[model samples]
Target chain A: MKKSDVIRAVFHSLLQEAPNKVWQPQHEKGLGFAPTNIALCKYWGKRDIELNLPMTSSLSIALPDKGALTSVSLHDQSYDRIILNDQEVVRDSAFAVRTSQFLDLFRPQKTGYLQIDIKMNIPVAAGLASSACGFASLVSALNDLFDWKLKKQSLSILARLGSGSAARSFWNGFVEWYAGVRPDGMDSFGEPLAFEWPELCVGILTMSEVEKPISSREAMQRTVNSSLLYGSWPKKVAQDLAILKQAMQVTNFPLLGGTAESNALTMHATMLSSWPPVCYFMPETIAAMHKIWKSRKEGLELYFTQDAGPNLKLLFLEQDKEQVQQLFPSVDIVKVFE
Target chain B: MKKSDVIRAVFHSLLQEAPNKVWQPQHEKGLGFAPTNIALCKYWGKRDIELNLPMTSSLSIALPDKGALTSVSLHDQSYDRIILNDQEVVRDSAFAVRTSQFLDLFRPQKTGYLQIDIKMNIPVAAGLASSACGFASLVSALNDLFDWKLKKQSLSILARLGSGSAARSFWNGFVEWYAGVRPDGMDSFGEPLAFEWPELCVGILTMSEVEKPISSREAMQRTVNSSLLYGSWPKKVAQDLAILKQAMQVTNFPLLGGTAESNALTMHATMLSSWPPVCYFMPETIAAMHKIWKSRKEGLELYFTQDAGPNLKLLFLEQDKEQVQQLFPSVDIVKVFE
Candidate 1:
């Protein structure tokens, strides 16, 4: 249903009760939300999403404090209008279709004000888990309005319905999402590690480029099917998972870093060797890694791990932040983000 | 000085001293001898050997029975005389100089009856390690006839002086050369992995064509002086050596395979990324790897590897040899060298 009709109906109903007050939905208030997450170990290929059979499972942490929160409200009034820059605007079909699919479950009636303002500054839909935050926001808004009071884990299911990675954002620190083969999707979700593994510090080195990323959805599908090394996927992932879990327990940097980096390379190489190669690592990305390894040889506790994006996420000592920052180039814009 | 001269001198020297012996140097030796390694793991710069250091510290095995060996002797007769094809033939400076060097080391007379003849079935000067076996034969003939009793290790040093990888031909199985920093050429040569780790099985797959390889000497020099990744050399070699040694201890096939394969890619990548790129993999070689990986996804235990050459060495269980062989388009001509 159109936002105008929904807004008109909401005000119409409210007008019935008060016979005077009128309000309308605003575009700035976005309706979806999800938490932020970084995979300690990552999942690559999927064996079966029907059962969440992941090629590999990874440990991830959810960021809550700085994450986005979405708010949506419906008000009556309308000229059957959509607006951009205070001017009429039209909705995109695919996006609208996707949003409508989720909105239908919460509000069967179209009458309402539509406000969609996403407050979090964290990037979404690229390497970072932006969709997790966005969808989480949407799901949360629906839950808040309906008084669903769903548990965090239960809400994650709804968030995941929009994007698979959202499940990781539901949990706090270090969680493992098992890529199991059980027929029901319920078999795989977030299970947190201990509340704290104090020695962990991850440094994100975002490249300077702001160009839109090739959507992960399309890349992953292409890599999974067209990579020359595609067949090694499940087996390699299975092997990596066993080692990854052990590394998390012991916090073995070598084991953890080596496997993580190699897995990332394999993931990227899948794209390079695809039938139609797709390169996401910019010259900056390659240079950043070179510098990190060069620094690593100098006895700094620095290791880099990448996730599908050009940004170089470095894992280093907390004490070495400033020194590490000094060593890094192309990261001119730095923010002390958690 | 050249092939013809070396052949002539050796021919004459053997006829003079040994009176009727033949000196045959093996053909088909390899040059790219890096352990299975990666560029990211080692060198990085756009320059060369300087940046990435050496593309590899390869581990290889020499064919004991199949490669060539020669015997030579000198006798008091006329000027240096050469005999080959069962007849006295004109000797050139190419054969003369190399044979003369060996002669000077033994029977020191400039003019003497030297009888030397070479019988080699393997392709001469091919990337197949022709130089390896050839040089080893040259040194072996010099050592044997004169009762120099040179140790295999000593012969390796001499062979390496002749060509970086030829020295490795003295051994039969898993061997690695330590490319170290002792300046007077003291710290680099191949050594065998101790016999305790005997599970090492090498599969030698020969590409149909036999062409010249980038002499490890030229390639290493280029890599050491020009590659951007040069600084990472010591650490990379240290890391690969340690990892490979560990793999040796546990005999982990997949780890060893990946490490070796990645190393080979690193070596080649550095070459291609050089000012002028050179490729060692053909479409056929790529196809072979793809086929093997395809089989692996279907649950096969076959593993394949390659050196600087296009030949792909495939390893499989004795039971599955036939099945594994069938995957390649060239099974009919594939020679399984035990």
Candidate 2:
């Protein structure tokens, strides 16, 4: 695959055929990569100044089809190029400042024009780690350039500094961010809560025209400070985490799903009690719940969870996925971007 | 005095002047009494079915001015003289049916009536125990005909059958109905969370209104069934009740006022989660909460609570009363009518 090897092999053919050759050496190159993350049992409070830990266990996040990727080959010598979401990242001076800050946290030594074109399919701010997708793209490219053979956790440590939830991107399947009792009080550092078993799968029903009306950062802090109901929620989170890990071990819907639903409801209930209050459910969102609850009440086992936005993530037993899907045929499935 | 003493006095009066002695008869002389009960801490929500026990503590309530009274004296009566709120109670058949139901709950073991006269001044369910007042009044006159020495508690037991909260009307301040953990469950009778503490005073903010959109009976039942947050609430009721009582004992404004705000908020929160979703707050009700929150956030130190209606029940430390009232000089003030 060496350029010299190709040139030598072609040289003989070129000399024999008497073909003309032009040098015109003028192109720059860099790298690009992106990763995905899934929420474990812990969900962060949006408003906590520190991007504090979750109130309960929420499972199932849809990741990008392939992965975040971009080609950094220069189109010209002097003019460097960058691409994002499959479009050329324009040269904005402010983006320059932000990119530097982003790089410092994501990839310190590997810096330049980062002549790259990016293509990402991750949904932005839809209660998914879009930031991680972007940072993973940038970080993975730098790791390639500097040959920094670091493990995923080490990379995630860099990601965490850029965006707190970004640490979860390093692992696949059932993740947990241990809220360590650190003196510096950073608390959260992500780790996988459970290993993957192919039987465990997830499907989401997104009900949002946009991300959430309020950011998770603002919402969580308000609840922690203003809500009288806040004290009781963290306990529920612990219980949910325990129940979920056990459920994943046993590999059953009854225990696993019931725990997830309880945790999701508790988290939404916390939102309802915050100072100004925010309703995460639309009529359709609740309609979805009614459909699930009715089906279950009629003795069908279907389960769902909701994030800060209107998305309803269904957790069905791998055995009953088709049946559950048929039960909710009216619901529009969200095309998983990331 | 004694029946004979009453008879002698009547005869003497007749001799002294050919007085207009309208001789009203007994058993044969149809009569009834109606009395009002006051709620101190206030009763909300039903616990047991057959016997009504509330989940929260409440206080004893008697007629504030005196026993709530209404007299229905039989005289082959002139149609049906109904006087209330200084207006003739209209001769409506529906009204008659309702009146009869009130009488039927406690008519001396098959007492019948042909004609009657009625009068009362108590305000009806404008968040006032007018029914208690009316029922208490009807029964007091009947006490004359039957010569029954019914204690107030016994009468309250009967009144409670009419409207459970009216049980508070039969007694004075500092009354409590112990929700005994009996096999059959003792009556969740009207009980006082606080009695006649000389320093404990209440100032009401009365508004011009007829009644709430939903009755307590319907609202409470719907709320208990519909609130997903319901289960979590009962867990804290015991603690809330204990804390509020302690606050009352010490006249601790922060403790008492804050707890009251929380309890009232939660009661309404349950209403919002009702099956069809009931908003007990009038537009004015919401505006009041806005004002209080805005003012307090601005360091004005003002707050309010609403019953199941539009009128605002502003809560402030006794020490802050003057300033609080000054902030809304237009709001009317009334006694708790305990």
Candidate 3:
């Protein structure tokens, strides 16, 4: 089925009405913001590619202020205009093309064109999940522009039509994205957990701010298609998800950190096993990892998780923030709970 | 059954006589040498750790002259004396302890004590399979010392009592070690393949010579016990073994190199999925891998395989020796088929 049919089915299920009927403009312009998230239990494989349905559930923590801010307004042109970081994106670029395609899902009948401006606090395409928060904030802006008054869960499903991880960017704390069984993904949405640890912190170690050679979407597809170890990934995610939740519930930092680190390594392990081998680690990435391991061995409570790109996200408690920062002077620390 | 009992049973079955009955000293001194081997299809998990029986069959190519040589002689001392590279090893060291334990299975009543001197061309404990060649040479020396005319298969089985990979080090060229289904491991031994590729070359890229923090024995045990991805390792080995043999049969260098590289990476992937994560890659190792991959993309036929340490062995052909040497200046090249 087409992505638009799935979107209409989702809107029909959630609002009991057509999207055009509820897409009435309430204002000339709308603004929205969303926090980026890092998955403690990673989302590595897909069950439905077109609908962005994951093969297993995942858990993530949102960075409080490191995300995307999007502003949207009705435009007179036939095609949508897109701007990123105050730079106009060319019409035929991959980014602009993808943004326009996602906008196609929510175009109002009376107003077909939109001007979208996005400002991301983190590096784009550098494993920072910039697309996630960008898509999520864009969905939020669309919701506000049409005065839909939808809940976070419904907005999450809409954002997921653009990117899978975008489903979990709607919340500012711990969030869990359910990998629903339905093919149309009517039930797959992010849910915010009530448990909160005010002392949790995430440190970003930016080895490279340049774009990754291989996108996470392509990497995930390659891993699932070729990696023999990919068969065990769902089981790994399930176990880590449980441990992550239990650790968060009791404020057990070590258990949480260790599991998150292992989960990320396992995801990369699958990628490494793929044919023509997808290795995202640079020389500096390996050096940083060895440094972290050595410091952790020497009685430092430091743990790290890596995404599809070469950068790392250090997971430590607020109590060790000073020590961690001292050890990694260039780290950009984010107060995850704050 | 005890290891000693298993050893005795194997001797009885092979010789149709007890070990001591055939342990007559034909000469006062005996000398033997063996070549070290690099696996194209790696041996990772073990089905029977006590017997050193692998979970699946593996294929390897031996590096001529880069191996171990040992001399053994009857001694008057009450205890065995072991010397490595002209230096006497302390009796309590791990190497001495393991050697003595394996010796306990082959002690003769007429010669209660012996002195052994070993010389290895390759660096010890540097993922170069020094232990494999060492044990194989020791077993061969014992065979000559006792005047026991055992076949290569029997010697392979005896060497495996010390290290699993030793079973494949008895031959000079390509050897396949069968993972026999017997509990006593009677059928598990190396069989030399007749296919000879005179142009095949192996280049040693030594990133580290120090002993690994975790031995391959302990690493294999931990991965088999804890790594969820290890469940698929046997299947990977089976497929790679078939492909390696086919590649050899047709003299397909690219197929052989690609399959071998993928096999090695899959083994490391399982280790990464284990708890506490057994990572063998140093920063330099990662840098070398990226260099090889980039060169391959730019029309080089170079590939590499890593063992349980940070060192890598580059797989290429004699035709590209100068080019490969120019790309990797410090690489030590060996003509495998010579």
Candidate 4:
């Protein structure tokens, strides 16, 4: 038997092991899309390296219609072909390695090679959670192509093996990723929020399109290892998560916005305290933040949060979209609700 | 008597209260200069606001000769005339107010008005600690003009009332300021280091000459009152102080430099966690830090620290002065040790 046969046999046994959910290949080809979700209460450090489990529970709003799309199909070639945004990714690249590892999860007892072509509408590695959407779209496409009757939770678990935030991208509207108690990470997954406000939305100020100098993975690990201020952060995050969940339940825009912004600042503080320090905010990022704060002082409903990049994402209601647009006229507005 | 006369009478009474020390003015004019000191372990927050006692003890090295010079002389004018850098400071300006308050410490019974001429060679409010040197020089000049016969420790105490860092500029070589337990702040003052490494020095990179956007006082207060990460920092600082003191005793350059850099980062982390975020490091600051780290990897001995502004001060031995100068040739170099 060839190497592909070996992978096929391994994947077949794994699928058989899960007797409750078995998937047969329905179509040889399919295309799917997954939009990125911007975290309100961020998930920074990880708890399980192998499963990509977060150290703290996080909340985010999904931005649909614009994100990452992946096209996958059975191939005649000896190995999988991984193409990212119209360009074939180098086999040795981390992205390619991760993609191949994720593909291994779906191998059958006997099968041919496969090809995946990805198209990303959002900037990559600039803290927009591009990897999140990329893997989610890839997994969704794979599920459709293989006729995987796997539930949404199972898809999220599979996607997380590719990227931690990818688990959240499987859900729509406001979603929460529980930092579950199970060491095996069986309980860790994203769930759609029960309550949603129709007017909730986000305006993104893309300060820089260039890849960040320090990747989020490296930054998170460094912060977890060296930052003295990071020791008590999980407990603080637990407290903030409770406050944010309550605000979300009541549809309190101001409370939600304030809590999200505070959590983002707390994340940046840990990054700043790390050895050698990880500073991501460019001068333009701060300018955008100041603009949001100034407009809020003038009675505008606006608040800002940033991931591991220089971009400033302003959270506001649909009724004040025009006002937020006036503040950030150049950036695109992403509607999270309605 | 007018208010000025009443101030003079009260000051005289206070001077008389110190029975062990009193010197009648032999000459009615004096000129003094005091160089600013860069804190290795910074003192950010305060405990006793009225007495200007620091929340944590700090260590610094005094930069001599190149600093602020003040020429003070008794005059017959109704109020004090304050000339800063050859220009008369406006009466309502903060500079003028602080100067007048500082002079109130030396007022004598029935003494004539004093005209003060201050020439600041350093950049004010740019994190060079210009205020420290300015107040130190002013106090020194006043001590000479009034012949108060106050000790150096007493001068530091009076200078602290103007700017907390000013207290450290009173001594040359390595000095440490004790954050005394006394509420009256009688024991809080800068003391010269008993053991000094004469070869240790610093080279500065003055990235910006403009005044900082936020004053250090306001930044410290904001961080203390609002930053969630600041609560346990005092304890961490105490631990760092012990480590730094041990390093200093052994003249361990790397330990001293690394500790200083970490302390500075911790300080910035707390500032960044503040409600509005007191960010002082410009992009250039991070660039300079990277350069230092890269150079150190290339076997060059270099470490860095910053105050409340964008400027970066590099710490290295006197033997590496030529190499450091090559790195940052555009900025001026101030020697703190022989």
Candidate 5:
């Protein structure tokens, strides 16, 4: 059968169950999986909210097959319901409200109510970009169910409206988010890099499984609004992003590791400069960083990056993964991307 | 006796023991005590090395009677000797070398050697600006012994040659260090505030009594050379200083405290952005900050500022001192400043 005929047949089946003016399927479902991306060059602040535009361009490596799996199914309920990890999410909760709002972006005007079930293997709110994976997977699944026929780039644009970092999750391997010029953000989307470093390994030093006190969105807004050192962040990120991209293209491990670590520190610097200062480094985090530095001095070839929370993500080559694992015995080894 | 006549007589008496260099003086002595100043608006990075000029203007409150006391006496020996806290400081030590270099700035073409003794009650190198008080006290004592007839501004300038923060220590109450445009840096010195907030109270949260791993000088140099966020710091500091001065003039505790805390955080942010990132906040330092924040949220008017080390200096009203002291059981109530 032709691809168009397959899509038409699926839609015809989806419309069979309705008894009213518009028929709807009781159980038409689509599912998708997407992984979170660890930003080597951080995206800290925004230029516009309506278009979800970033103030700085960023580079990240996608962690495939170790993120969120989301399923969307048409239901008989009058309102949409969200179930997270086998539990019904409270409708008035911030997480539920945010997830519902994100889904509304894809809801067609005359569509029937749908139920979303998100199963996250990655811990949410642990500075691991679980939201990014969750939203990306949800968008992907909804697109598949409705036969939206949206291209990857268009999917990325839609995902960014849910979360800025979610846009980068649509791609595989290394991805770059362009800090586009248009006010409408028509040009802003993630693009996979031309080259890939297959030997790269990542070790996630998860400090806590609990949710962070301050959300990344709130932290970014605070830094943008009040941090004294925030003025030059965009230009600094741009410079680092250029250097990082070149290093990645050439597979320069030292350059890539150093640039990513430095860029992460620079991002934290803006948070530290915010009024009442947002400090995320716990004692364990500092100790972890010290161990990484010590290992590097002893020729282990390892570097680390931190996001808005206390957890750390260390990057190294496949040859040095064992050594990195030994040095941080407390941390979990994330093997999906490796 | 007349002041000039008294100075001459003192110098004449010093000539009794000195057989060379035209027999200047033998027993002339002077003593001074000066407390360190905590920069409410931090002075980081430098504009000039030779003259010790600051990159940006800063404000501070001198903590009188809570620092170092030094005595300088003319001696018959051919060389000068320094004894700190009753122990002879080694000539090759950084402190000794820096002190000698500072004294050389005061030496005329031909002058007799002197014996100096310094007693410091405050902990050294723990981010309490011990050097500032030590150098300021030494300079003040030397000025009196030699009858230099220097004004407070001139004394501040001389003291700044030893330590940048030392210039602010020369004044009682509040002080400001001007980041001068002059190449010679003659105009860059500390000036006392015309108005004073006598009812203010301070609590020093001393996390460690030991010396810090990295000195402020080395940390500042690292930040200036490598920190990506440091590019726009001077301008930000200048803007904050203006607001701080206005707040001081009005005796507005909220403005003064808030600005001080924000400025200190901004200063540390630059350090955290350095290539290796000179982060000084221990877990206790963060805890102290949180306590202050919590108290503030509970309706207490309190704020905090930190210098180059782990300690936190809290600013509050006299009425709030007891309550503030109760919150942080480990903190020291600095009665001298209050």
Candidate 6:
């Protein structure tokens, strides 16, 4: 089935026969913000590509300030206009194309057009989850502009139509995205966990800000299709999701950090086993990982998780921030709980 | 069961009621040579650690001339004397200890001592399967010294008591080790394949000569014990073994190269998913892999397989030797079927 059908069905399920009443615009413009998330238990494979249904549940921690801010308004022009970081995105660019296609799902009979302005604090398409926060904020802004009054859960499901991980970007703390079993994916949405540890910190070791050679969508698809080792990924995610939740609930930094790092490495391991192999690791990435491993061996509570790109996100407690920074001189530290 | 018990049982089963008949030395000194091998379908986890029985069968191609040569003689010294490449191996060294332990299995009596001298053309403990050839040659030399006149299958089983992969180093061409079902591991041994491809070449891209921090034995055990993704490793090996055999029969270079590379990466993938994660890739190893991938994308028929260390073995044909050499200027190329 098409993505639009899934979106409509989900909206109908969420709105309960009031979908038509919320379609009309209540405001001329609306602004929304979303925090980018790093998965502790990664979402690697998808069960339904059209609906962005994950094969297994995942947990993530949202970075409070490093994300996307989007503003949306009804436009009278024949075509929707998109601006990213105050720069006009060309009509045919991949970013613009994907944004327009997602907007088409909610365009109200192809007659209504909307102008979107997005400002991201993180690098785009560099494995920093730019698309995730961007889609989430756009959905949130649209909800406000139309006065849909949808809950965060409904908003998360809506954002997932654009990108899978966007489902987890709707919350500012620990969020868990359920891998719902239904074909329509109505039950799949992000829910924030109750526990919070103020001392947890995420350090960004940006080895490269260049766009990834292959998109995560393409990499995930190839891994699922060709990697023999991908068969065990769902099991890995299930175990990791449990460990992550337990670690967070008890404020066990080492348990949480170790599981997150292992989960990320397992995801990359599957990619490495794929045919034509999807290796996102650069030489510099390997060098940084060795340094992190060595420091950890030397009684430092530092661990790292890599995404679909070359950058590494280090997980450590706030107390070790000075030491972590000292070891990785150029690291940018983010206080997650703050 | 202990390793010694397994060794004794295997010898008893192979000799069958007349075990003492072949114990007399036919010659004053015995010499033997064995070639190192590269696995096309890797053997990762073991079903029985003491017997070294693999969880799945594996395929490999022996690299002629790049291996170990060993000479054994009765010694008058109270302790067994061991020399590797003209240097006396320190008595307490891991290599010497393992070698002496294996030698104890064939001492005939507790008081008998033997002097062993070995020469290896490849680097030790650098993922070049040096131990495989070393153990295989030692067993072959012991067989000659005792005039056992055992078949290659029996010798393979004896070699396995020293190192698992040594079971495949008895021949100089394609070999397949069976993961047999017997509890005693009598059926598990290496057998030579009938088909041969003289055009096949293995190019060695040695990124590091340093000894691996963790031995393959420890890595394999940890992966099996802690890695969730290792559950699928036997299935992967099974699939790759069939594809490799088929590819070899038809001389399908791409199919063989692709399967071999995937199998090796899948093995490493399992290691990467282990707790505390085993990463054999150095920075230079990753840089070299990227180069190989880029070159392949640019129409070079280059493929690579990595073992337990940072070295890469490039699989190409004789026709692409010049191009592969040009791509990796420091690569040492060897003809597999020579």
Question: Per lDDT, what order, best first?
Answer: 6, 3, 4, 5, 2, 1
Error of 5 at B146 (Å): 1.5
- Candidate 3 — which pairs collide? none
**Model 2, stretches more than 4 Å misplaced?**
A1-40, A46-48, A51-122, A132-138, A184-187, A330-338, B1-338
lDDT of all predictions: 0.52, 0.54, 0.90, 0.80, 0.79, 0.90
Positional deviation of A229 in candidate 5, in angstroms? 2.1
What tens-digit string does per-residue lDDT give for candidate 5 at A1-338? Answer: 54333333433333344313232332378787888899999989999764568998888988776789999888877667989899998889988888766654434454567788999988888899988898899878877776665677777777887889988998778898887886556678899887768788788888777788889998999999988788989878878888987897687999999889989988888887887678777767776777777678788889989998889999888897777767787766654344
Give a tens-digit lDDT track for model 4, residues B206-261. 98999898889889999888888888688768877888889988989988988888
lDDT per residue as tens, model 6, A1-338: 66668777677777775667655678889889999999888889899988899999999999999999999998888777999999999989999889888877766776678789999999999999998999999999988888888899999998998999999999888999999988888888899999888999999999999999999999999999998889989888888888888897788899999999999999999999999899999999999999999998999999999999999999999899999989999999999988
CAPRI tier of model 4: acceptable
Q: What is the TM-score of each predicted model, taking all chains together?
A: 0.48, 0.52, 0.97, 0.86, 0.90, 0.97
Error of 4 at B118 (Å): 2.3
Model 1 lDDT tens row, A92-207: 54444555544543343565535444566665444766656666776666556544555666565556556566667766566666654543444556666664545556666777
DockQ of each: 0.03, 0.06, 0.81, 0.36, 0.50, 0.83
Worst 10 residues of 4 chain A by lDDT: A3-12
In candidate 3, how many Å is residue B25 off?
2.8
Q: How many clashes in candidate 5?
A: 5
| TM-score ranking, best first | 6, 3, 5, 4, 2, 1
lDDT of 3 by residue, B70-124 (tens): 9988788977799999899999999998988788776764356779999999999
Q: Model 4 segments beyond 4 Å from truth?
A: A1-24, A74-78, A103-113, A246-255, A283-302, A316-329, B1-17, B20-26, B73-79, B102-114, B195-201, B246-254, B283-301, B317-329
Candidate 4 lDDT (Cα, whole model)?
0.80
Comparing candidate 2 with candidate 3, which one achieves the higher DockQ?
3
Q: What's every prediction's RMSD, in angstroms?
A: 16.6, 14.3, 1.8, 5.1, 7.0, 1.6
Interface RMSD of each: 12.6, 6.8, 0.6, 2.4, 1.7, 0.6
In candidate 6, the residue pairs with backbone N, CA or C atoms under 3 Å apart (3 or more residues apart, or in different chains) clash, namely none
- Could you give the interface RMSD of candidate 4 in angstroms? 2.4
TM-score chain B for all models. 0.67, 0.71, 0.97, 0.90, 0.89, 0.97
- Candidate 3 CA-lDDT value: 0.90
Model 1 DockQ class? incorrect
Error in Å for residue B139 of model 3: 0.6
